[model samples]
Target chain A: MPEHAILREVGLRDGIQMAARFLPTERKREWALRLKEAGLREIELTSFVPAKVVPQFADADALAAALPELSGVTASALVPNLKGAERALAAGFTHVNYVLSISEAHSRSNVRRSTDEAIAEFERIVALKRTQDGRGLVLGVGLATSFGCTLQGHVDPDRVFEVAAKVAEGGADELIVADTVGYGNPAQVKTLLPTILAIAGERRVVCHFHDTRGLGLANVAAALDAGVRAFDSSLAGLGGCPFAPGATGNINTEDAAFMLDSMGFATGIDIPALLALRRDVEGWLGDERYSGAIARAGLPKTYATAPRTAAAPALAS
Target chain B: MPEHAILREVGLRDGIQMAARFLPTERKREWALRLKEAGLREIELTSFVPAKVVPQFADADALAAALPELSGVTASALVPNLKGAERALAAGFTHVNYVLSISEAHSRSNVRRSTDEAIAEFERIVALKRTQDGRGLVLGVGLATSFGCTLQGHVDPDRVFEVAAKVAEGGADELIVADTVGYGNPAQVKTLLPTILAIAGERRVVCHFHDTRGLGLANVAAALDAGVRAFDSSLAGLGGCPFAPGATGNINTEDAAFMLDSMGFATGIDIPALLALRRDVEGWLGDERYSGAIARAGLPKTYATAPRTAAAPALAS
Candidate 1:
């Protein structure tokens, strides 16, 4: 178990945003509270994007308002521009995530802005964070399509590093390298993570991977070996990138936690508890596909020997 | 791209053994020829066990004799004992695979033999092969449940190494480490592969993984990083161990080829051609469940830039 690895639950924001039917605000709040109680320290609660463009997240502010004020638990929102950032701030979120696509074509199609203009907006969001009443709203920037793009293939590593460095210099508290199209392999991750880490430094680098090509966990192992400690995952492997065709889910949170916890990494998260949460999410979605293994096969018997409390009786039963 | 990877297609032997209905002998022969044409060097063509136990492979002798004699391809069969090995040799198979489960519980349930008895039988099979014809006959001893066993829960690494060493000393040409219950993680792989490789220094070590827990490719990457060059996979992700409950599907052959090819490794096999052959297998097993991503999503666009011919036409189209 490494001392620094962190797993951020993105099912609320990234997962629900891609669902066909909108989850009620009460259900969303219930999930957030249960997830935090399951030992997740940080969660991407919702996106602050416009209501008209993504109606699924129309109740982001209401959900944000209902979040339990747990000490040491950080609730964050995704913001595409300065307007989204302002809304997130107004909703009282202490953490804001701004995503900018590194591929010009994908950026233009996804956010309707050129790469440079998106970076400019990121700078504006960073500047706005400084003037707010110092509740210390941390700003994080994600470089989407940092691996390869659907529209533009073979995104340059230099471009990814450059964007990462620029965002860090512009006052982003952290920079996440994302495989938006799920086009990355372990070799690609090995090639790209060092450069991004070198530019963003050790503490600022977070790795986000997709399971589109079935290389999600392999990519995570590669990044972990390369010294990445923070990861973004969707519960039950929910969510698909609307812009990236066939990009159906992020890495499964329980699967990732199981991998880390079994390897002696302290995730501080309960594996079976997270798996139980998956069952609840599945009931809500009915037949919609959700990806994960811990939900299918209960945690291995050896899990009890690890440094964690006994799994809940209800979950084990 | 390493120079020594051996991708053994197990679709015919392990994949179809559990199928409810038997595929026509001609269809199996067609699959053999197509796989050979696609440049798969070694294939587990069928099992030579009693027809009463597995009726699906009742035509093993006929199917083996019908295979096209290609220059680089080596046809192999799974032999449970000396009788099965004799049958395989009589049918002109140049290679024979002997199964020896490392876990005592699994070995008993799977073959009704103790681990020591299985190893003794392996030695007898090697002796029998040597007495008849030695040149073209390659003997590979597969150590199933090397990582962990479903019934036993934890397989001791020392026991795995000792059995591998004893098998190698007894006359096996190659050794394969199998995660019989899909209980292996990258960390466990990292810890075990080196020890196995060190003990069986002269013999080739092939890794056999199942996607039961969705860590198949991750295990491959870990083994590859640890210098393992050979792997075992089934087309369309077919096959499940009857003795190892909850074990479903070997690592998908097409998906493994795609991952290796995408990472700059030359499998020598054609990716798209394999996908087409996968469809043929799927058609044969009318109601069977088949899995793999490359067949569903096609190859990533970067595949076109490789020094390979165009892929075969899509299976569904």
Candidate 2:
């Protein structure tokens, strides 16, 4: 991992999943092309949840097929169960993201599965990764509602650490701590991040924050202070948790990139281009409420222009 | 002076000044009453600009008259020039905030005076404070566009320091470094804050950030780490500088207060109450854009309640 930060754009999967209107597969592909051209290295292409649950991601396979022929960008998809994992694997995606709700109530209500059942499925997915070529496939486990749960208030940090240890033991290549409902504050982020990093180690830790309660960036700062590097963000601050009512949106990718770039940290993404892509997204969504500061304010007057990095050839799986 | 932070609300003045519609005086008074009830102790009520320039504050006199009953709340007003200062003084406000643009270009464009002339007027304002009833009236001399000016990029830190030193030498009680056009980042904030504080000393250093480029809260955290305790925020993240096109809103007060309260730094403001008041403002503004996360997300499930502090009795003049 270079010192540069990685921002995985979750708008395609997490953003449109909650929209009232479903975008056509072509539009999703267009967004993917725009994001790739903007130098976003990783894009969560879509989720494999059943069409009945979220119609917005109903064209997941179509989108996965239409992914632009961009080299160096890793296209990933979200899987909630063994079936979703199978769909994602069949779609030729190199990376699969699995989410397990740490809050037992949330787990049951969201995926209709007990914690043990979810773990069993996760173990199966890890085993499946071994049978495949294994070189190209990356398996990431996200511990959702790690900070606090809406249905069950005050998620114990001890439980989160335990789950992280289990995920690490189960052979997840990456582990992300998610404040699914945006109940995380900087202090809580500081308290929980170190323990999770200790269990999962540094290379595996990724922090995902929602701006539901306005602590998204603050939590990011706290996690950075705690030594975690990779982050998950959505373009235009799209996406709200279906299970978490009033949970507004994910941390905006362009805004987060701008913040990181301005802090003297290299993000390897073009801030101006990322903002331009936001305009494309807004045009696609039409009447949706898109949130982010960089999209509205443009780049600051004193923005230090980032030097473009040579594009690495697209990885051949 | 306490380990806690103080977020002085500038919404009524800074927020509404750039608004397209003028709020009724009665509605403005109601906002003040509700903000006071929400435990906001310091509020910049209105700017004493000419009615022709900013008709939104035409009722500054009536607003000031209504503020005396708020007891422990310190009602302050912004004075653009000597005439505005006279109006504020005559309105019975003991605390008046004066602003001087540091960038000579910004100073000329904003107040139609050169930087040298603005400093001279600041000296006169300090002298005018002495001629008053000797009630120890507080005067805050704000260095607008201290970080970077829109018209002139790359504001020199030395000039910022010079202005701070001059303001303090002119006998102003407080000094604030303002990012008037939302052009500041954490690195710049961390670097320049100490230099300004070294010149202005500890308690006098205040930071005002605009979230125009999405680094507002991050900049605030950087300032806090640099030992700054006083901040300026607007309720609902209102206000934008019209002269600087593409300028976004200020840092939202309720959101900032929530972050501070959650960090175990006491801000002495009720987070939920402030959010509730945001609803009223949204209704009053109707079609206007209001930015804040706390109001939209509702309160977090595990929100730690603020420790209560009984309001001190109104101090005698």
Candidate 3:
């Protein structure tokens, strides 16, 4: 049996945030169902934020309501703060990822709060998750700009370690170290991940990499070597950090999954199905830029996509 | 001092081969100089093929003669057989890489000969290289389609080991495992490279990967992990395999350099200069499809391109 590696799709939330036109709620739902069918066992479907901030993820509640239809799929939404997490819990979300940028400037610019304030909010959310109504909610925190921040220039690894220590101790179930600016190199990932993982201790360490400088997949490969088993990816490499101008696409979901699958890691992703979804999404999100290689070149002739019925996402080699 | 890793520019040969319009000889000289000025110590300037076959390389002699101007740069060209190599030797090339496909079908389609015939030709070239004039020449065998092929699909690992053993014993000075069809995965690279390296023993093993399926740099990272110190890259990712339909770009020279630079590898590549070269090459080759990330995203604010004055390209960490 191959070792499991979870690649959760963030196209609906992270990817679509960049799309100019608002995709109808039905379209987002359709895409979500297609992603689930395409063997994406875990999908981050929406972000709970005001429509004024990001109109694309305005359908967060609506998408959250459709989670029941996505049986067998581990669905998640991104929540900005205590209020957002509370809303997600009220909307019946089983999982919500709270995002906090490690960079002081990025944190203020992105969520209109300081890094310490966000940390306080995260603690509040964790406390909220312990309440009667939030009993079943899984709270995950994404440390945005963990690798480096455009606003702050080089983000110190000590800062990342400091944040991870705080978040892990705050009772977070999982921590996602993000290369929000796409400034991360494989060496940085290799050097920093061990420390971040060490700080997280028993908590799961997931990585979110942007393909900004084209090292996204490479960083993922390094993280895999560092014992990380889960990743956050956007479809067709959609989504860019608005904070980092000229930065485009998250580490592409299809590309990341294809890479993992080809590496003999059990991703349980149907690449053909995922590519088909990419084509549809491209048509749907007409103006948004897409970045990836497999869709353009197509899968190699030797590829055998793992069946979705695989018990877990794991490594074969 | 960081350990040395060489990133040889193949954009002039591998990249421009895909260009529809012929670039002037002067333009080629200018780009080659620019590449060297950007601190790429090695550059695969052209291929020694008959002009009747690839008119793009018709000026091979002119470019080879111009090599004298590229002082301090280790330039090479591709030779199909002993005759082309003799032409290169006569033309003053100190290095020539011989092309051979691991896939039998690809070998026939690409070089118009059986794999064994090509091997025989390779042996003939090695014999010729050992003589008085060829003494100074460095011989490298690029086993194309070693990963997977568009024509024959998966090229067996045992077959790769066999070819490496034969080439190493047959007097080749260097071995390049090329993912010609862009079918290589990191797992496959990490798996195959150890054996290939073992077979090579004292001889160096370089990697030439096509970004056909987007895992180029990831594979580079894997090869680096397996102890490969040199790689072949194209400016702006300008090349593609003729046999692989829809394939675009060898790994982008600038992207690969940037990746290595970020990983703290001593590539001695001036990425800002490389990006400037990419812009010029992009303008020169108007229609050739380009693939890469850093060029589009620009280098991060924290990036400090290696000083061209550096003595070697090696790992710093």
Which sequence of candidate numbers ranks them by lDDT, best first? 3, 2, 1
Error of 3 at A61 (Å): 1.8
lDDT tens digits, residues B94-212, model 1?
78899999999989989999999999899899889788664557888899999888778788888999999999888888888998778888889999999989977778888999877
Query: At residue B78, what lDDT does model 1 achieve?
Result: 94
Q: State which candidate has the highest lDDT.
A: 3
Which ten-residue region of model 3 chain A has the weakest summed lDDT? A308-317
1 or 3: which has the higher lDDT? Answer: 3
TM-score, per-candidate, Cα-based: 0.94, 0.92, 0.97
Name the regions of candidate 3 deviating beyond 4 angstroms: A312-317, B133-135, B312-317
Chain A TM-score values, per prediction: 0.94, 0.94, 0.96
Better of 1 and 2 by DockQ: 2
lDDT of 2 by residue, B22-101 (tens): 89989999998988888888889999999999999899998887867777888899999888888999898888999999
lDDT, candidate 3, A1-317, per-residue tens: 77778888988888888788899889888998998888788889888888789888777887777888898998888999888888888887889999998999999998899999999999899889888442678889999998888878888889889989998988898999999889998889999999988888888889999899888888998898888999989888888877777778898887888888888777778878888988988898897788778878887888764465555444332
Q: Candidate 3 chain B: minimum summed lDDT over ten consecutive residues — where?
A: B308-317
DockQ (0 to 1) for model 3: 0.73
Q: Where's the lowest-lDDT run of ten residues in candidate 2 chain B?
A: B308-317
User: DockQ for each candidate?
Assistant: 0.46, 0.47, 0.73
By TM-score, the best candidate is 3
Please give the TM-score of chain B in predicted model 1: 0.93
Model 3 lDDT per residue over B197-312, tens place: 99998888889998888899999999999999889998888887777777887898888988987887777888888888788877887877977788788888888744655654
